[model samples]
Target chain A: MGYKSKLSWADVTPKAAYLNRRQIMAGAAGLGLGTIAGPVAAEVPLDREPNTLEQITSYNNYYEFGVQKEDPARYAHRLTTDPWSVVIDGMVDKPGTYDLADLLDGMDIEERIYRFRCVEAWSMVIPWNGFELAQLLTKVGVQPSAKYVAFETALRPDEMPGLRSPVLDWPYVEGLRLDEAMHPLTMIATGIYGESLLGQNGAPLRLVVPWKYGFKSIKSIERITLTDEEPPTSWNKANRREYGFYSNVNPNVDHPRWSQASERVIGAGFFAPRIDTLMFNGYADEVAGLYTGMDLAKFY
Target chain B: MALKDTINGWARKLPTWPVYALGALPPFWYLYLGFTGGLGVEPISELEHRLGLLGLQFLIAGLTITPLRNWTGVNLIRFRRAIGLLAFYYISMHLLAWLVLDIRDPARIWADILKRPYITIGMLGFLTLVPLAATSNKASIRKLGARWRQVHWLVYAAVPLGAVHFVMLRKGWQFEPLIYLGIVLGLLAVRLLRKATRMRPHRA
Candidate 1:
C-alpha cells in the first residue's frame, strides 16, 4: 500500500493493452518467465537451457516492492506497465525516438537461459525473452564514437514513489561501455513471468545485461544517450565508493559492505547460507575474454 | 509473611507469556501469509512494502521501549528482548525479501551493495543488530557483561540508520519513511537527552 502510488511496478502492458495473457507473456521468442515452470531447477548447470522472461520475471529482484523473501510474488501485481516509449538520442548516426510498438516490430526475439546474480549474493537462472542489444543498436546505427550507452527512466515522482526519494540519481540512469553494449548477452526485454512484464519489473523496455549484476540491466528505459566521456550513472552518482560503472560479478571482488564469496538461490528459503559464488557468475568463460587486458579487480 | 508470600506469587504469575506471544505476531503474520499463498501474486512489491514497514514498526517498538518505560510506568521490560529480537527478525525478513523475492542474481546482489549506498547502509544496519540480538538473553548478557552494553549500544546507531537506509533506498524522499525517521529520531532524542542529563553530575 505504501509504495503503491509511487513505484507500483513497471507499466509494461501499454503495448500489450490489446494483447491476451498468452500474448503478453511472449518474449522476443515465445518464452515466458517460467519457461519450464516450478521454481527453477536447482541442479541445472548454467549452459543447460536458455533463460526467458518467463523464468526471469518468474524469479524477480525489485526491492522497491519490499525487501522480503518473496516480496516480488507478494507485491508484483501492483504494477501497470503499459503506454511506454523509448527516446533514442545522443551519439547515434541514425537516431529517432520510437513508440513501444515500433520498437517491438523488427526482430524475432528468442529465449536465452541466463544465470542472474545480484550484487547482494543470490542467483537465479531465468529464461528471458529478448533480442540482443546489438541487434537494435545496429538498426539505430550507433556511431563509432559511441563508447558508452546511458539509459534513463521517466522521473515520475508523482507516480514512482521511489523517485520521490533521493535514492540513486532520480530517473535511474545506468550506462554500459560500447563493447558491452554489442555483446551477445546484452538485451532489451519487455516481458517476464511468461507475461508482459509487471509494472514493478520494468515493463516496456529494460536492459538485460546478464553476466554482470542485475542493475546493469536498467529498466523502464526512457532515454538512450551515447557519450564519449563516462556519463554519471544513477548508482555511481549517488554512492561513488560503492557503485562503479563496471560492476561485473566477480566473487573475489568483495562489496564494501559484505563479502561476495557466496550466494543463496532465490526461492530456496532461509537456512541456506549463501552458496559459493563463481567467477563471472558462472559466465566467466563466456564473457571473461571481453575484459582480457583490463584488470577485473580494478574494473570490478 | 502473608503479604510477602502473596506478592511474590502474584509477581511470578503476572502477564508475561501472552505479551511475548503478542510480540511475535508480525513474524507469524509473514509466515502465515507466505504459507497461505498470500504472496502468490506475480510481482512482489506489496509483500516487500508490508515486510519493510513491519520491520520499521518492530524497530520503532524496540527503540520505543526505553522511552516508554521512562515515560509511563508500563513495565514493557519483559517484552523488550522480544521486541528487539523481532526488529532483527523483521529486518532479516525484509532483507531476505530483497534477496529472494527481488534480485535473483548473485552478481547483481554484489553490484547492488557496491553500487548502492542505501543498500550497503541498509545491510550494515541489519548486520550490526545480529550480535546484539544474539546477546539479548540473560545468559549472553551475563556472559558479556559490560561488553554486552557496548554491543547493544549499536541499536541506537542502527534504528536511525535503518530509517536512513529506508529513506536512501527510495528513489525519492516519500513521506512514510521520513515519518518513520522522524519518529525514530524523536524517541532517540528523548533517550539521549535523558542519558546526557543523568550523566551531568552535580556541577554547581
Candidate 2:
C-alpha cells in the first residue's frame, strides 16, 4: 500500500514562484524565455509538496563539506564553482575536459520533482532543474563496450574540511551500470527552484537517481568515466555488507543498522507519522524493470 | 591539597536536588527546539541524538566520580546517584523519541530492536540501567546493603555498550564516537588498574 503524505500542495510555496525566479535568472543569462515553457509542465508523480528552498539548502548530505547536515551550507560557500569543469574519459568518443557551460550548452534543462529517499530512512521531495544523464552520454558517444559509468567528486582539502576526516576515502566516488546511466530518469542537476544550485546542494553539477538512495546521487561531480568493468563506489567499498553497488530503495532490504520499511519526511513537522517506504521509492512502475529477476534482498 | 579541600568544601555544600532539577531541563529544551524549528529539518533524529549523547555524558560523568575522588581527593560521591538517575532519565527519553516520534509503529519498533545490531546493543544498555535506576534510592540502598554496590556495577557494562551503540550507528568509522568509546574504556581501565594495585599490596 502506498502511503499518502500528510502535506498538501497548498502548504508549500507554489512551483511558479521558483519558475518566475528562474525566468529572471534565465533572462539575465540571455537564454530565451521559450526554453522554460516546454518542460515546466512535464510531470513526474509527486505525492508530497516540495520542501522549502531553505529546508533543502540548509539540510544536506554533501559530506565533502562536512559529515553534519548543516556542514555543507556552512563550508561549501568557500568552494570555487565558477571555473568548474568535468573530465569525461574511458570508452567515450569525446573524452576531454569540458567546461560546465560548454557541456550543458544545448541540453534541455527541465524541472523534475522527485522523491529523494536517503539510506538513513528520511526523505525529501526535491524539485531539481537539469536534463537527463542519457543526453550527456549520447552527446559524449558512449562506446558499446562500456558496461559501467564511474563518477568522482572534487577533492579540495583547502575548500572541503570533511576531506580531512578520511570518511570514505578522499574524492568520494560513485558508479552506475551503463544502462542505468543512460536511463531517462537519471539527471545531472545544476539548479533547484529556478536558482543556480547552492554549493551545498552540489552547486555546479550532481547526479540525481530518484529510484536509488540519495548517496547514489553523488554531488559536486568532477570526473565521469565510462568503463567496461563494474566501478567501485565509495560507500560500497567502505562497507560492502551494508551498502550494495545498486543501492536501490527497496523497503524489504534493510540497511544493516536500520530498517528501510518506513521513512520520516523532512520538513513534515515534528509529529508527522513516518510514511511507509515504497519499492524503488515509488518509482517501481518506471524503474523496476531494471532489476527484473535479480533477488534485491541478495543484491541489495 | 588546599585547592582540593576548598573544592570538596563547596561540593559538600552543593545540594544534589538542583542537579536533578537542572539536568532535566535539556530534554524539555530539545522538545522546545523541535517545536520551534531550532533543531533543523529532521528534528526527531536530532532530538534523539542529543538526548542519547547527553545520557552517555551523564553516565561517563557518574563513572568519573570514584576516579576523581581517588586521584584528586575531590569528593563528588554525593552527586553520583543523582547523575546516574539523570542519565537513565535522558536515555529513557531518547528511546521514547525513537519509539513515539520517529517510529510510532509497534511492529517496526519490535523488529528494529531485534534485527538491528546497534539498536539491540542500545536496548541492552538501556535494560542494564533499569535495575540500577530502580534501586538508586536510600530505602533500596539500606535494604540491599553490599548487594546495592554489586547491582550498580552494571554501569561498567552499560557505559561501554552505549558507546559501542554510538560507534555502530554512525555511517562510517567516525572519530567522534570512537573518542567517546576511548574515554569510556580509559575510565574503566583506570578503575581496573586501581583494583590491581590495591590487590598487589595485599598479595605481596
Candidate 3:
C-alpha cells in the first residue's frame, strides 16, 4: 500500500472547534448566506443561539405523550427507544423494515443549528445532529413515480399515554413532496446538542424540515412510505382550514385562529417582544423556489 | 340534611370580603411564578392562559351558587356578589395581561379584537360583565330594583360566551375546553329544568 496517513481532520483541529465550524457552515449554507442575506440581516439572527436543552426537552407539543406542553417531558421517558426499526415502503426499489442503527450506519452525521417554528406561533433555535434525509432516500432508492413521502410516528398506547385520548387520531402522521423530502436541507435528526434525542424530542429518528412548521417534522418515525399522490398529514387532516399540506412558515398566510406575522421565541424571557416571523422561517432562499407561483394563502 | 345545614351555617358565618382579598392573591402568585421562571418557557402566554382559566373557573363557580342552594340546601347567595366581582376582577386582569405582556402593540391588539372571532366573543363577554360589575353596588341594586336582576341575567350570556371563547382558542377539538363548555351548558340546563318544573305546577 502507498504511504497512508492516519491523521484525520479531527486529529488536526480541536474537536469542539471543528464541530463549531461545521455547525456554522451548515447553518450559513441553510440560510443561503451571502446570496440574499440583506432581508434577514436586519432582524435578530434566529439560529445564532441554540435554546437550552432544559427548555427544549421540557416544553414540547408531542400529542402522542399528551396535549399539554409539559406532558411530553413528564411522560415521554416511558417510550422504549432501543430496538427501534423503521419500515421504508411504497414506490421505492428496496422496501423493507430496517434496524435504526443499520439504516443510519456509515451515514455522516452533522450538527445543524436550525430555527424550529411552530404553527402555533412559538419558535426555538435547535442544534440538531443528523444526516441529510436525501442520503437515506438515495440509499433506499426512490422510484421515479414517487411524488410524496409520507411518514408515521410510532403508536404504543401502553407507553404513550396521550394515545388513549382521541387527540389528532394517534400515530401522528406527516408528509412532504418528494422534491421537498429530497432537499439537502431536509434532515433526519437523531440527537439534540450532541446528545441522543430525548423521547419528548422525538427519539431514535425524526425529520427536521426547518422551513416547514414544526408539525411537519414528524417524531419517532416508524414508517416512511413514498407515494405517487399527496399523503395525509395529522394536523392537515384534523383541520384543513387551519393546517395545510405544505405548512411552510409563511408570514403572510395566517392560521385561521392566530396570526403568523410574529412568533414568540422560547427561552427569550417573559418580557421580550415578539420577533417578526420570517418567510419560510428565514430559509426562503433555499426552499421558496419549491413553492414558486403557488397560492400560499389559498393553500394555507 | 344535617351536613347541608352545617355547611349553610358555615357559609353564613364566612365573610365575603375575604373572598375578594383571597381571590386577588392568585394573579399576584401567577406573576411571581412568571418572574421566578415557574411558568416555563413561554411565561407570558402561560400567565395569560392561567388568568383566563381562573376567571372562567370563578364564572362557573358563580353559576353554581343558585344550583347549590336549590339542590343541596347550601345558601351561598350572600357570597354571589363577591364571586361575580371576583370573576370580573380575574377576567379584567387576564385581559390586562394579554394587553400588557403578551401583545403590547396597540394597533395589533385592536386588530386582534376586531379580526379574530374568539377575541370578539371574549370582548363581548367582558362588556357584558362591565354593566353587571358597575351595577353590583347596593346603591345601583336599590336604584335599578327589579331591573338589577334583569341586568345581571347578562351573566347567563356572559358565562356561556366565556366557555365558547375557551373552546375557540384551542387548535383543534380539545376536550378540556369542551368540558368547560359542557359544565356551563349543564348548569344552564339545570336552571332551565328547575324553571320548567316549577312553572308546571302553576299551569296545573
Candidate 4:
C-alpha cells in the first residue's frame, strides 16, 4: 500500500505480480508454448489473473534409486531443504559458508514462464519464481577474477538412493560464464507457480539457465565455486560427444542421437505430441544480446 | 529328373537371400526415416509409435518364417536370421525413442524406467536383445556351444516384454496392441505346436 516512484513497463506499471509472466504468456499465444494464452496487457493488474501455473516437477537426477522419471518426485520428498548452507569460494572477493535464509534474504522473486527443454528433446512450460543469479553474486561482491560461476549439489550416496550410480560424478556441478551468470534470464529459483518449490523441483535452491539445456541448471547445491577456468560438469565428464560445457540451444546442431529442431512437450499428451523449439526457448529478446556476434552453430 | 533337380537347387537358395532382405527393409527404413526426419509431422510420438509397431512387425516376421518354410517349398530357413536381427534392430530404436525423446532428462530417463512398470519391462525387453544380437554371430555361438540356446532362451522373455512394452505404452487394450498381442500369441502357439508334436512322436 506504499506510494511508489515511476518504474516503467512492468516495474511501477499498474499490473499485478503475474507481471512479465503474462507478457510472455501473451506472446506464447502465438508461438508453440503449448495450450497457454496470456492475459491482456495493462499498466495495472489485469482483471484476468494468470492461470494456476505449474512446475516441471521431475525425478531427482540421482541415478542410484533407479532412473525412473517419477522416482525423484516420490523420493525427493525425503530431502531436507531447511537449515541449508552453501559454501561460496574460489575466485570470489567474499568467500564464506552462508545459511540459506541469509543468502535469500530481502530478494525479489519473479515468475518466469519458460519452456524447459531437455537434451533428449522433451520440454515443458514452467512458471519459475526466482531471483536472478546476478542479484545474489552482487551481494557477495563477485570479483573481477571470477569468469565463471559453478554450482555443486549435495551428494550423499547412502541417503539419496539415486546417487548410488557412478554414471555421473555425484555432487553434480554446472557452470555459466560470468556474462551468462549475470544475464537476466539466469535465475536462482526458489519457488514456482507463486508457491514454494516442492522438494522434487530442486527445493531450497536451483539454477535456471533458460538458454542452456536443463542439465546446466544444476540442482540441490552444497556450494558455489566461482573459478577462472571452466568447471568440469558431471555430464561433460561422462560423455564428451553428447554433453558439452557450453550447451547453448541451437536447432542446427542435432544431438547425435536426436534432432533438436523440435521437442515433445510432456504434458501436452497424445493428441499433441510436441512443440516447436524456439530460439533460446523464446527468450530471444532478453538473452540474444549476450551471444552478440558469435556464430551459434560453431559455439553450439 | 535332370530338370527337377535343377529347379530344386534354385528353390533351396531362394528363401535365404531375398526374404532376409525383405525382413531387413523395415528396420533399415525406420532408421533412415528417423535420422532423416521422414517419420514426420508428429515426429516424437509418431516415431515412437512406428518403432514399436516395426518391432512388433519384425517379431511377426521372425514368426512368419516358419509358416513360409512350412507352406512353401521355398523354405525361408536362412531368412530367420535377418528377421531376428531386424526384430532386435526395431526394439533398439524403440528403446532409443523412449530413452532420448520420451523421457528427455538423465534424471527422468532413469526414473521412467524404474518408476513406470511398463517402461521398466520395455527397457528389459530392449536390453535382453543385446546378448542375442552378440551371440547371433557364429564365433559366440561356437564359443558358448551348448549354452547358446539357453542364453538365447532370453528371446522368449523378450517376446513377452516387447508385447508388454507396446500394450502399456499405448495404455489400455486398444485394437493396435491387441492385434499385436494376437499375432504374438499365434506365433508362440505355432512354436508350442511344433514342440508338442516333436515330444509326441516315435509311435511311427
Q: Name model 2 segments beyond 4 Å from true.
A: A1-46
| Native contact fraction per model | 0.04, 0.70, 0.48, 0.00
What lDDT score is found at residue A254 in candidate 3?
A: 83
**Candidate 1 lDDT score relative to the true structure:** 0.66
Task: Summarize candidate 2's per-residue lDDT along B1-204 as a digit string, tens digits.
Answer: 999999999999988899989998999999998877799878889999999999999999999999999989999899999999999999999999988777776777888899999999999999999999999999999999999989989999999999999999999998899999999999999999989989998988
Per-residue lDDT of A240 in model 4: 78
Separate clash counts for every candidate: 94, 0, 0, 18
Highest DockQ: give the candidate number.
2
**lDDT (10s digit) by residue, model 4, range B11-70:** 566655565567557656765664443553234566677777777777777677766556
What TM-score does chain A of model 3 get?
A: 0.86
Superposed model 3: Cα runs more than 4 Å off = A1-42
Order by TM-score, highest first? 2, 3, 1, 4
Each prediction's TM-score versus the true structure: 0.65, 0.92, 0.91, 0.56
lDDT of 3 by residue, A115-140 (tens): 89999899987778898899999999
Using lDDT as the measure, name the better of candidate 2 and candidate 3: 2
Give per-residue lDDT, candidate 4, residue B125: 82
TM-score, candidate number 1? 0.65
Model 1 lDDT, residue A190, Cα: 68
Candidate DockQ values, in order, are: 0.14, 0.42, 0.33, 0.04
The candidate maximizing lDDT is: 2
Docking quality tier of model 2: acceptable
lDDT of each: 0.66, 0.86, 0.85, 0.66
